[model samples]
Structures are given as C-alpha cells and as structure tokens.
Target: MHKTKISVDNIVDNQTFIPNYPIKMSIRDVDFFYGSQQALYNIHLDIIENQVTALIGPSGCGKSTFLRTLNRMNDTIPGTSLTGTIQLEGVDIYNDFSDTSMLRTKIGMVFQKSNPFPKSIFENVAYGLKVNGIKDKAIIAEAVEETLQKAYLWDEVKDKLDKSAFLLSGGQQQRLCIARALAIQPEVILMDEPASALDPISTSKIEDLIAELKKNYTIIIVTHNMQQAARVSDTTAFFYEGVIIETGDTKKIFTKPIKQKTEDYITGRFG
Candidate 1:
C-alpha cells in the first residue's frame, strides 16, 4: 500500500484563494443511518465560508450521504435518522429550535440531474422568490437576470425567457437549475455530482463556475472524479466504506495522501 501525506491547505490553490471569510459551517461527530444500517461514521469537518470543499470517493462510500446531512435533506428518506451536530455560524442546525425550512433557504442544493419544474425559464427562477413573498416584479426580474448571468446562462437564453426549461439542452437545463438555486441567494450550496451527467465541455464550464462561485457562496460537492476535486476545491475529503480516511488541501491529498487507502483510490491503484 502506498502511503500519502495529508495536509489541509493542499485542497485550495493559493492563486485562486479568497481571503478573510469566516467559517460557515461545522460538522462534528456526525453519524447517520438508513433504517438499521449506519451509512456514515463519526465524521468531523469544517466548511470555510466562501470556499469550495470537495468530497471525493468511490461509489457507495457515503460522500452523498454526508452532503445531504448538511442541509437536512436526509429527513425526506423514510426511516432515516441522524445523530450528530451540524452547525451553521455557531448555531446547531439539528436543535429543536432550528427551523428546517428556514435552514434549507440558507443552504440550497443542486442535484446530479437537472430537475427543472414543468414551467418556463422565468417561472423556474422566480419560484423561490415568489414562495418567499417577494411581490415586487422589478426586484424579481433584476434578481433573475443577475442569477442567470452568474450561472453563465443569460446570453444563451435571454431572448426566450418564456420558453419551457425542458426545451434546453442538458447542459443549459443544468445551468438553469443552478440559476434557480442562485436566485435564493443561499449562503451554502451542496452539489452532488453536478457535472457527472454532462459532456467534457459542459463539465469544464461547471467547474469554472464553481471556482467563481466560491467568492460568494461556500460550496461542498460530492464527486467521483479526483481530477475535478483537485482542480476546483480548496479542501478535499476522502471517504471509504462510510469513513473519512483523510482530508486536507487538494494538492497534498492528491500528491501525498496521509493514508494508503486514499493514495490507492486517487492514483487508480484501487477504489
């Protein structure tokens, strides 16, 4: 087994690093279960505000499961239970006083598949704002434009805002979904394999967007692509069989992993 050194700063490249942001979220001794089977171990991690943290591992390694716990997305699954502390800005998210719906508004999610509702492009992005009772049309329109531009989809679909979102290509649709998420102005965005279904060009575009997005929103992504994690994230955490083997800066995790298992997984020796 090849042993790799683990260091935290290797995850984010200094050239693209942002400065002076606070710690946005923290996960301490997190454990999860689906019915009677536990899916995650005693996981502890910190998500820096305005930076990207990538969760990388092979299939069924609990990366996705861990992502869902951050925003309480796991509550939807029947018989699912979580026992741990997930904090947002020093407040415990799992506490009884923590409102799940309000928590979700602060932490948005983008899925692997583009899941636009059966509505026009304009309506899709406006849904969240409307649900929150923002009745000013001008404000809504301005926000829609700003978010669309941020997602790099404004120029492509600017002329047909009334068109059905399903009419767009897979990549465009995915960007629209991102725009929808951005419309809510969530402080943190959890993405599970956001680029897994796209072509090389689309994947590259998403990666670039993620790099840019870290300046505004803290990001946590679950990805199987080691190269993608290394390229886009400030921090990288490796998972194996429901355990976090090692986590640190992306460079060290890729070039000098602290554990033999992490090195093997990253170097293609074995998953």
Candidate 2:
C-alpha cells in the first residue's frame, strides 16, 4: 500500500482541501423534519473528497437521519420533508434538474444489515450494472470482477461466482454489498451503523476495508462505537439532539473535546 503524508496545517487552516482537490459534497443549513417533528436542525457541513468522516452520537441524535439526507433516501418516507440545500459537486441535489436515480448512482449506500439479494453472488454484484443498461455480458463480467476486487471480496468468492450469496459468511456478505454499491461507480459511500450487526471479527474486517477504501471513495459512517469511529475516521463529528455539537480531528474529539456534551458522551458519562 502506498502512503502519503497529509499536513495537519492544511486541515486546520482551511476546512476545505487544497486547490485541485475540490469537495465532493456540501450541506448548507440543511434541516429535516418528519411531519411536525424536526429530526435535524440547521446543519452545515462539508464532505471533503476521498476522506473518511464519521458521525458519532447516541441513538435518536440524527446521525443516521443526516446520512440518509445526502442521497435523498429520506424521500421514501411519507410526510418527511427537507429544508435547505445539499449539493453534490456544487449542484443542488434537491433542485428540479436533479435526477434522483442518477444522484443515487453517484452516491451509493450500505445499510447496517447485509441485505444481499436471494440470488447468485455474481448476479448480486451485477444487478446495478444491469439496471444501468450495460447489456454486454463481457462488460458486466469485467465490471463485477473489478468491483469485487476493489471491495476485497474477489479472492474469497471468485471461484464460486455462481453460488448463492446467502451461502457466504456475514462478513463476506457485507463486502459483497459493498461490491454491489461500487459496481455503479459511486463517488461517495454512506454507511449507517454498517458493522453493528456483525461479529467482532467481521466488524474488524469491515473497519479495515473502510480504511483501505478512503483512498478511492469518500466515506461517511454513522457508528455508536467510539473506538470504531476513532479507528476508521480521519475526522469525527459529534451530533446530539438533532444538532452537530462538535467536529474535528478524531484524536482531539476523543482525548480533548472542547464541548461539555462531547466530553461527557465520549467519557461514557451520558448519552
């Protein structure tokens, strides 16, 4: 693996990355409400290109709610509405010109549970490509192989491509879902408690995979596990009661948080 030294000064002096490295997504004064109750306050944050950002907070803190908003997943819920702007590559995703399907293709998502289709492993990974109208079998096969390799699951299931995806272990299934997401060539990957359902070993594998994936894809993970957030994220944002309380370097958030609420929560004093 190739390693690069990223200057901390660059991260501190500018919330944005250097020139030639434009941000992939930006959220400006975004608020979300379900019917009459607001789930997220006026939240403003920027997602840097090709970096891992973690959302950590107690349950009902709106971490997951905030994640879903990025890809317009919240639109599926009736009576739920959004106020303010969420931009992908400088264009508002909520605008009239925005295509929800195309936006979803650009911004893929992985849920907490490994919900693979009840189909062959090959078919599961190729489903997205097929939906996108890539009819050539060779093209689909090549994409499936490349995506699986990128997801770190090719070696395990390469020989059994025709086997049912359900036959794979929990960890393998999660990686397969990741492969499925990558098959569409997404720019950002949103994960909502993706490892909570897996065993310790499986969770460790997923964490390691996320660390590796940051090189090629922007990742935002919502995790209740402080240690997992610290292990996998470069920046950590602490949310509470539908607001972002604090966000900074992961080390600082864990060891020396500036806010009382952040400190209390990290120290296990309260939710």
Question: CA lDDT of each candidate?
Answer: 0.86, 0.87
**Per-residue alpha-carbon lDDT of candidate 2 for residues 51-125, written as tens digits (9 for 90 to 100):** 888999999899999999999999899999998899988889999435788889999999999999999999999
After the best TM-score superposition of candidate 2, give how far the Cα of residue 148 lies from its true spot, in angstroms: 1.0
- lDDT of candidate 2 at residue 238, scale 0 to 100: 87
* lDDT digits (tens) for residues 21-52 of candidate 1: 47789887777899978888777787888889
Backbone clashes for every candidate come to 13, 0
Worst 10-residue stretch by lDDT in candidate 1?
1-10
TM-score of each: 0.91, 0.92
Candidate 2 lDDT for residue 225? 94
Model 2 RMSD in Å is: 7.1
Candidate 2's C-alpha runs over 4 A off are: 1-21
Model 2 poorest 10 in a row by lDDT: 1-10
lDDT of 1: 0.86
